[model samples]
Every structure is written in structure tokens, then in C-alpha cells.
Target: MIDCAFKLQEQAFTLRVDHRLGAARTAILGPSGAGKTTFLMALAGIKRPTAGQIHVGDQVWSDSDKRIYLPTHQRDIAIVFQDSRLFPHLTAFENMHFARGAKVTTLQIRQVIEALELDAFGHLMPRQLSGGQLKRVALARALVAGRRYLFLDEPYQGLNRELKGQIMDFVDLWCRDQVEQVLITTHLMGECSHISDEFMVINGLGPTFLGPLHELVQQESSLKQLMQIGIENSLACQVIANECDFIVAQLSATQLYVAGHAKVGEQVVLKFRAEDVVIAKEACSMTSAQNRLVAKITQIHQIDGRVLIHLDAGQPIYAEITPRALSQLRLERGDDVHCLIKSMVLRVA
Candidate 1:
């Protein structure tokens, strides 16, 4: 059980939360100053709330009525912050052992390292590792610190796509494996949607929206209808052909494309994750997805791990699929596949 409520008064803002989140993955999502991080800090026992009740499992960290408070360390919670503060002098192994204590055997250390994919880097000092690597080590150390309830304060900040994906995937898998409960704060609703079982969206709040992530997404359909996804090149496409979860569209004079949906000449929006918009390998039928197009993979972006592939779809819609999906689709600068998108996946954009 995770219960939290707060009455906040700050120079710039005041937040009051009266909410309950079960033993599931709950995320705090909002803009910069929406008190997401503050809430995480409160839950981690790092910051005290003005008035509220904070509970996890059988313990109560804060209570307005009872005036009960649990100090940070005594609360026994693991925290992964936006900035992973690994000791400069300490190696990953040293850090883990320090956090884990003497009771943790070498086997446990090995398991943590393996689970976080830090086996090779475990011996390296914090300075020698990448940003993603540092966060992984930090999280692993926290996990070893004997805290079952985890509070992550923007764990994905300042990492490359590949590294971010790796950390997030590892975290997701680790959460499932340990049945760990997480209360995370993030600006990236996309990642939150993929990972968290529930979402707590709040800012300088009187009321925070707390509910299932999917349900919230459904409720936002109308709002999203007028809103566009990623600023990457966007365009409206005419669904020329439709199939099971797939649609074929003629994007250009020479380029023909297939994607997730089409309503036979109906104008619809399509998103091609610059990464997944790979060049085709000569129109093939070798994918679970049916939308493949023959067009020029115009450009590439090397952002803070994954490369972005830009393809010329007559009109581009951003399909934010996984990097792995991009690779498996075998998209390149000039190659094409029957863009394998199912029809039902189409949503009004």
C-alpha cells in the first residue's frame, strides 16, 4: 500500500495531495515545477511535507494528524535521482558493497551487476562510466540498500537514447522480477506510459490526477486529436489501402508506404520515429509490420544513444516505436518494406 497526501506552501507554489496508490508502479508526471520531484523527495524521506500522510507497505512515513515522521534513512527506501551522485573515488563494486553492507554476499553483488548490465563496468570508478552506467550503478546500490519501495527522481535525464532505453528496460524488468513498487517522477510521459502501471500527474497542485496510465491516455484522446506528436517532420497521409492493423499510403510520386492504418483516401496522421523511418531494402515482405515504403532515408540524428533516421514519406507521421523495432524492420536510407502497421492501431491524431 502506498498512500500520500500533502498541503504545501512554498515561495513560488503550494501543493496539496490527497491520494492513494496501491502496490504498483506509480509515476508523478508534470511540467518542470509541478511538484513531482518534491513529492518523490517527500516519499523518500528526503524532504518533509507541510501536512500529509505518507505510507508504504506497513509503515507510515508522515502523518499530519499523528505528527509522525520517519527520517530519511530510517524510512528504508531506495532513491535514484536525475543526477546520479556516485562518489568520484569509489568504483562501482565499492559503491555497491558500501550500500549493500557486509551481509550482502558476493553472489548478491554479482546478481545486481548482471541484472543492471554493469558486469564489465562494475570495477570502474564513477568517472570512467557513462551517464546511463552511472544511474544503473546508483540504482543497483540503492536496491542493495534494503529498500523495497523505490523512489526515482527523473532517472532518465541527460542520457542518450540507447542508454536511456537500456536503463528503462532494465528497470522495468528488474521491477517485475523483484515485484518492486516504484514512485517515479518524469517529464517523459511516453516512457512512463510504457513502464508505470499507474500515473500521478501533478504540478503546483490542489488536485493531482492519479489513475491507470492507459485509462488516462484514453481520456486524452480528444485533446490529442488536435495536438501533434514529436516536432519531427509531420504530414497528413491519405490511406490508400487498409489491412489487418496495416495501411498502405502513397507518400510520394515514386515512394509507396505501408503503415499501421488507412481509411481509403481519408486524411490521417502518421508518425515515423526518425529511427524507424529507415531506408528500405527494395520493397520486402519480411516483417510483422506490413507498411514498408520505397523512399530516401534523408537524414540522421545522433542525439544524447539512438540514431534518428529520417525518411521521406509524402507526409510524415511520427510513429514512436522502439529502437529495436527500427533495427528489426531493417530500414535504411533507400530501402523499403511494406510498413507493417496494423489497422486497429490507428488513432485520430
Candidate 2:
């Protein structure tokens, strides 16, 4: 568990955070200049807090009253900053090796390089690598360090959508198998939804919401922010079958056909935009949509002239529809409905 109650005075506002985060994987969300980075830096011991204390489990990292402070290196942490801080003189491979000081086995290092697709550019110097390549190197360095806590700040900033998804898969697998805790800060909520077990939203001054994504989306302020950026419905699934064109995933009691490749028995996250979901009063077999599940309306929110419908079809799902459509369906809380989604629209995250 990470128990922290600290205050840091930023130039614009005083950032105050008081929370006990026990989630294995937590995603930090907030607007620009909201001090999300500041909070992460403080947790990493990069920036000292002006007051209060930070305790991870039974270990006290920082306590102003006790006059105890642990340096960055002393903490069991590895961080990937927004910018890659690779050694200028060393090659990418050397940078990663230097971070771990050769403590990790050669096979372990090789596996990380291959998993991140960094083997090809490992010999290149930091000056010779591209922005995306540099980011990959920084992430590789952090993973090789084998620390207890992993902090990633916009780690996939410069990567493309496809590459970002691939890297996220690798990171997710690595975290599940190796790390104890992972905290990441990202503007794109859906991008990390698959890996994050809980979310922390830092607003103007400090953290305003900290909970599961399903609960966070229910808040008026958080829902508005999510709607502005376009909300995504992320479902936890397990691959049951890998067909030639798509993969069959089991979502609780329902089966979802996704347009992606995944080995059978592998756990994956199915992501689709809320706008892509269509709600129906009853299941329709005449439609071309391949995936349909019976759901019950849990909550309805009308924001920015659009209606956001929350549903429970064994798992939480969101659908965005126009106010006119909402009126046409007359969707009310507790009404049973069917969610229709085309297979092609579903992607593995």
C-alpha cells in the first residue's frame, strides 16, 4: 500500500494529496499544468514535499515532522520521465545495462530488448536515435532495473497508435509478472485502461478522484473531462479462440469477437469507443453486428448536448448517443437493453 499525505506549493496552486493507494496498477489523469507530474516526482523522491509524509507499506520514505527523507536512489523505484534521459555518450544497449549495473542476467536483458523491439537499435547512440526510439530505450532501462515501483510519465508520448498498443501489451505483461506496483501518468485514458486497475485524477490543485474507472466515470466533473476527450469502453476478456480473421474473447458470461490477434487463453482488454455502441430494446439477429449482449441501464448523463448511457452487461459498458436517440429509446435507469457492436470495431488493447 502507498500511503501519502503531502503538500507541494506550485507556482500557480498548492498541490495537496492525501490518499492510500493499494491498487497494484494505478493511472494518474489530469489536465495540463495540473501538477500531475509534480505529484509523481514527489512520490519518486525527485521533488521533496514541503510538508507531510510518504509511507509505502511499513517503510517511511519521507516525514517532515520526523526529519526523515530517503533519496531517490535509496527508494525501490525506477522512473521513465517524459523525456528520455539516456546517457549521451553511451549506446542504447549500454544505457540500459548501465542503469542496472549488470545486476540482471544477460538473458533477462535480452528478453526485455526483444519484447520492446529495441534489439535493432540497441547499438545506436542516444544522439543517433529517434524520439520514439529514445522513449523505448528509457522504458527498457526502467524495466531492466527490476525495481519494486515503476513510474512512467507519458511513456508512450512519441509513439504511434499501433506501436503504443504493442508496447502497452509488453509493459502490461511485464508488470503482471515482475513488478509490485506501477503508476503511470497519461492524457489518453483509454490507452492505459487495459493495464490500470485504478485511476487517480488530479485536477486544478491536486487529486480529486481516486478509484476504479467505472466509478470515476460516474463523477460529474470526471465524466465531463472524459466526454470531452471521447470516452472508451474497456472490457476485460480472455481469448477463447483465434480465428483466421478475428479472435473470440470471453467477457464474463458473454463472448466478444474482436478484430485482432491473440493466442488462445491469453488475457486481453477489448476497447471500443462509446460512440460505436448501439443500444436496442431487444436482441436483433437480422442486423450485421456480430456481437450483442443484454445489458441493464445503470446511469444516464446528458452532457454537451449528448447523452452518455452507462450499462451493466455482466461488466460495465458505456454508450454515447444523441439526445434525440435517447428520447427515441426512452432509456431509463434499470431498463434492460441490448448493446450491439460490430466485430471490426472491437480492438485488443
The top-ranked prediction according to TM-score is: 2
Instruction: Output the lDDT of residue 138, model 2.
Output: 99
Candidate 1 Cα errors over 4 Å, as ranges? 101-105, 128-130, 218-289, 292-349
- lDDT of each residue in 93-208, candidate 2, tens digit only: 89998888345677878888887899788999999999999999999999999888999998888887787888888888888878898999887677554768898888754346
Q: How accurate is candidate 1 locally (lDDT)?
A: 0.62
RMSD of every candidate to native, in Å, equals 12.9, 2.3
Task: Enumerate residue pairs that collide in model 2.
Answer: none
Residue lDDT tens for model 1, 1-349: 7777777676677877888888468877777787887777777777778887888768888886898888888876778777889878899979877787444567766777776788888889899998878888888887677566778788767666545655665676666755458777876554442345676767674456777633443334311311122222233566677778556655565323543444688865443333243344455566554445544455434333344444445534333334565677665545543343432332222
Q: C-alpha displacement of 260 in model 1, angstroms? A: 17
lDDT of residue 80 for candidate 2: 93
lDDT by candidate, in order shown: 0.62, 0.86
